[model samples]
Target chain A: MSRQASRLDAKKVNSEFLTLTYGALVTQMLRDFENAEDVNKQLERIGYNMGMRLIEDFLARTSAPRCLEMRETADRIQQAFRIYLNIQPTISNWSPASDEFSLVFDSNPLTEFVELPPDLTNLRYSAILSGCIRGALEMVQLEVQCWFVQDQLKGDNVTELRVKFVRRLEEVIPAGED
Target chain B: MSTYYFVIVGQNDNPIYEKEFSTVNKELRKEDHRHLTQFIAHAALDLVDEHKWKTANMQLKSIDRFNQWFVSAFITASQIRFIIVHDNKNDEGIKNFFNEMYDTYIKNSMNAFYRINTPIKSPMFEKKSEIFGRKYLLS
Candidate 1:
């Protein structure tokens, strides 16, 4: 192979390597702090910052960028939740009976092969997910409250995460006239 | 002898599996971690939440000097958290040990026998532990 081509290939490989390396590093940090709630808070803060950069990357990588509308962006986010994370998020009706929109987890990869210790039965372990989704959405400037409504470990067999959007992120939005 | 505590936290910061191990030379009961274990869990939670906004994946070695212990965290996709804690003296070995262990853990989690937020009592854990000790500590 030509030297230039070799260099280019190396660059491509190097970039790919960096991506996995970064992913593993983040997963490892979350793992280390998994035992400490305070550290987990720090981890989430780290995640929020990451979501900001990641959103930029997500936009740069795709060929067709802009969503047709606000609802289209929301749908794309839902699709990304599945394609990227392997977890399909269900959108539920939020009416008088329902408090907020929820992203239900039919199969949670994070919780697989996990059993809660007896003491934590009352306290939900999935708070990290809520915090994460909230942090990610917040990066896009969406104000949301995400929490675990049901945990499979608690015998519900279905994990439900609810996201209540408080308001659109107007501050980050572009300005024209209002 | 040193002691190590490891856990896998989901996107929600919930523990999927937790295991406590003291130096193989020392015999310690799992029940001993009742209090310290919770303390460790809380610390990890704090670290995860604190880094919720950072774009780069991090290795926060020795976040606390008082304990002479270091924490290594891995956060993926703004989802999934994996944490391992150990002493500073053997930090190098611990890193490689965890990298290998993670491969096993991921494979183990994929098995039908596995479920989230549960104790990691699979015989494979012991088998892997023994192998890890032999490969790293024995030499």
Candidate 2:
């Protein structure tokens, strides 16, 4: 596929449509759930569902090759994010085993002009992104645990997410039965 | 060339859609194959639940075998399950078929009126799946 066709056209969607719709959705969830923690979990669950399906579209559009290493997976995620969302996040802090890493976003479009109430300090405003990553990775047979370690909305300079590779899922075959 | 049965099960374990087809290379009487295929697909569900948590990959190839019947499965993150039963054993072809079905499922889900885990009644989805089966498996 041509690179131009793979990239999501920003012209097709109005910027205000994304900003307003996402902002309103979050606000509605916060109201319906009536608890910051519940709202955060709900957002993550919604993102998880969306991510499950979105990965198929991502793969079809990018035609990306399967990553042979965790580092490559991180790079693929970065490329996917850039092409789909038009934002780039720096990936760093790889563990010695190369099973864990962090993604630091300089600017998060989801939280533009958003402020968390003092009572909702415990809520992870960008938990949905983490959920998306987790769901997408799981689909590719990589079981991972992803959570936000820092958020710009919470006075952090950058939004940081820590992803820990749990284990590779192995296909089970009946032993001595086939 | 053999008969094939395809089933889409909801997260709640309810069947949402099903179809049966035979390979073009060999003709099998549809009436003769109908009940056996349904039984095979239904019997494979228990094995699917047994093996689902053991792996994270969507394509669960050849989860169960009963006599000559073989079953493979593809699971979505929302917990939807795509199960296939066939007399011929070809894991690679089944995986590719499931991937196409997954794409169709995603498109169907995008409809504003469609709800997750509900029986898929869209004629568009049905037609696409039929075409995929004819192209990839029947021929």
Candidate 3:
């Protein structure tokens, strides 16, 4: 049991380490560039690139076999987000009136028990989460536009995020005339 | 001896790092483009390839480039590699530099925003690198 406990501790350490480090990096980058807009752009760019690469690592580490289709891929993303980040997002609604689907996180772990620094209250750290979703969707060649429709922290009555599937991204098919 | 270039290569031999510097322990002009520095970095990389085959892990001075440059390598338990190449002017100072660099690198890597194995040439990197170099190396 000691071994199992040790492993759990290690995993927790690693997760916290990643979170702290990423936060510091973003904070420092924003300061260096001296631009909040640029910082957000970097955050998204970084998230997309990271998501593309992390999908491979996540697959390798989990060794859960594979996802057979885009739907499965999306499911896998939801599962990973739940287990790794402790945020449970539910998929719902997606209609012409909304023009986008929603991933409702009843509780946001990154922001849980946490208050944003005074200057950063307006800055959204979870933007990276949106980027990751977009990149992961793109990897399976599913074209989508994702954004935070609502953030509980920002005085929205409902804490929710909506992702819109704009159009199907290019699919890399096998080489064939067919 | 003359100079050293050091880089971090993963299991796939992709360059996670590339830094060139004179062993002379004097700062090059800030205007000096990365090319001149990266030129000698070629040699340091050659040394890394040779060393990886022999050692499972490296310490503070496992690999030294002449009297001018010293290469320090670290491979995370996950097999992510980190390489630090700086002048041997001060080992303690160099160690501290690597620590800060590692902190920044790890954070950047963990960021959902960044891709793995990407060059650390972002504006953030430049800003942090300058701050770190000034604090540890210049002071």
| Candidate 3, B31-125: lDDT as tens digits | 44346434444455556566666766534344545445455655555555556555544566666766787777765665444456666544556
Question: Which is the better candidate, 1 or 2, if ranked by DockQ?
Answer: 1
The lDDT ranking, best first, is 2, 3, 1
i-RMSD per candidate, Å: 7.7, 14.1, 9.3
Model 3 pairs in collision: A46-B113, A46-B114, A47-B112, A47-B113, A143-A169, B1-B66, B5-B41, B23-B68
Model 1: what TM-score?
0.41
Poorest lDDT segment (10 consecutive residues) of candidate 3 chain A: A1-10
List model 2 lDDT by residue over A40-65, tens digit each. Answer: 88889987887787788778877889
Q: How do these models rank on TM-score, best leading?
A: 2, 3, 1
Expressed as tens digits, the lDDT of each residue in B1-111 for candidate 1 is: 666666767756667666655664444444454466546655766766576555464444333322555566655443556666655456566666666766776656544
Evaluated on CA atoms against the true complex, candidate 1 attains a DockQ of 0.03
Candidate 2: give the clashing pairs: none
The whole-model lDDT of each prediction reads: 0.57, 0.81, 0.61
TM-score per prediction, in order, is 0.41, 0.52, 0.45
DockQ of each: 0.03, 0.01, 0.03
Stretches of candidate 2 off by over 4 Å are: A1-7, A172-178, B1-139
Error of 1 at A14 (Å): 20
Displacement of the residue B82 alpha carbon in candidate 1, Å: 30
